[model samples]
Target: MFTRIASALLVAGLLATTAPAAHAQTTAAKKAAAAKKATAAKKAAAARTAATKAAAAKAVAARAVTPKAPVAAPAPLTEAQASAGVKEALNKGIIKAVQFASEPDGFNLNDDIHIPTPPDLEIVKSTVGRLPGMGLVFTQLETQLNRAAEAAAPKAKDIFLNALANISITDALTLVTSGSTDAATQFLRRSTQSQLISAFHPDIEAAIDQVGAGRAYATVTDKYNKIPLMTPVNLSLADYTTQKAVDGLFILLANEEAKIRKNPAARTSDILKTVFGR
Candidate 1:
């Protein structure tokens, strides 16, 4: 009976010890699993935050690269406005041109408009230039021809203004809308060329006589005629000077017209600023 009692006590003691050890192992395992789950959740949250930041950065970059829209063009002008503007431009241009051309050295110093030895008198110049003291005669004649043109330049202003005053509305509109910088000047030339020649001839002739250009030309021709086998050159100095002076006047007018058309500062009047500022 005693042996049976001792064996039962030993078996009970072993059961109690094993139960406590198993409970400790189970608690440890639950703590480790909870720590690993928390770590995994923190990693997922960090990844989400990084993704959101990358998406926001990409959006900002896209916005930075986009282009802005262009500005709209100015509105067009009315018919009356166009006509008035064109006439004003022409008027201003002619005034400046005449003033500039009438100034001293206007034609003489300007190679573009300076009258050269007449084509009709080239032979006379070439032959007579070889002679002593005769070269001065041709030089003096050339200078005097430019002087005549300069003297005749002032006569063009009245004629040009009259033409401007009489310019038809249709013509004015055509010039304004033609997209050409010198359209008005060209129109003035086409319409007033004949009138200009007629008006300038008398003044050019008188200027030539006054400036001694006629005498110098006479001297040159006399020398050429005296030379053996040279063709006698007889050109009307007034006619040639009138043509060249008119042409030079138109050139200056055209230059002024271009400036008014293309440059904002050249638009002197309110009408010109309104019409061409567009």
Candidate 2:
């Protein structure tokens, strides 16, 4: 009976020890499983963070590479506005030209338009230049010729403006957009050259008489005739001075036209700004 009791006690002790070891092994296995699950959760969180950052970076790069909208172009110019603008420019040019030409010595001092000895009468001038005391007389005639031109210059403003008013610019936009500063001036020249020549002749003839060009011509011719064997010259001082005066006025007008057309400050009008401000 005692042996049986001893064996039963030993068995109870062994069961108690084995039960604690088994419980420890089960707890260790549960801790390992929890650590693996935490590691997986951490990896999943890092992947999501990396994916979110990459998407944000991609969006930023796309924004950086995006193109801007294009700018709108200006409205096209109308013919009416173009024509009026050219006319305005012409008017301004004409006024300035006339103002310049009407001033004292405007023709006399200006080498560009100062009347030259008639191209046909170079021999007459040469003969006169060689003759004694005729140099001074010829100088006087030259001065008087310029004075006649000056006298006729004031009449040009009215004539030019009248012609400009009557004439039409067939293609004002073509002229204005031609990018040539002298386009408007050329238009004025082509339209009014004939009328200007016609209108200037009578006034020029009168200016010649008024400025004593006849007396100067007589002095020159009389002195030339005295040179003997020189062909007797028959010339109209009125005709020469008139054509020259018209030509000079147009030259001045061209300068003024360029000023008004190309220089912004010379625009001096709202219409000009509207048309050329582009």
Top-TM-score candidate index: 1
lDDT of 2 by residue, 41-100 (tens): 999999999999999999999999999789898788888888888788888889888888
Where does candidate 1 have its weakest 10-residue lDDT segment?
A: 68-77
Name model 2 segments beyond 4 Å from true. Answer: 1-71
lDDT (tens digit, per residue) of candidate 1 on 1-278: 99999999999999998998999999999999999999999999999999999999999999999886888876767778888999899988898899989999899998778888789988777888889988898899999999999988998889999999988888887888788889899999999999999999999999999999999999989888887876677899999889999989988999999998899999988999988887
Among residues 3 or more apart in sequence or in different chains, the pairs in candidate 2 whose N, CA or C atoms overlap within 3 Å are none
C-alpha RMSD of candidate 1: 7.8
- Residue pairs clashing, model 1: none
Question: How high is the lDDT of residue 97 in model 2?
Answer: 85
What TM-score does candidate 1 get on C-alpha atoms? 0.76
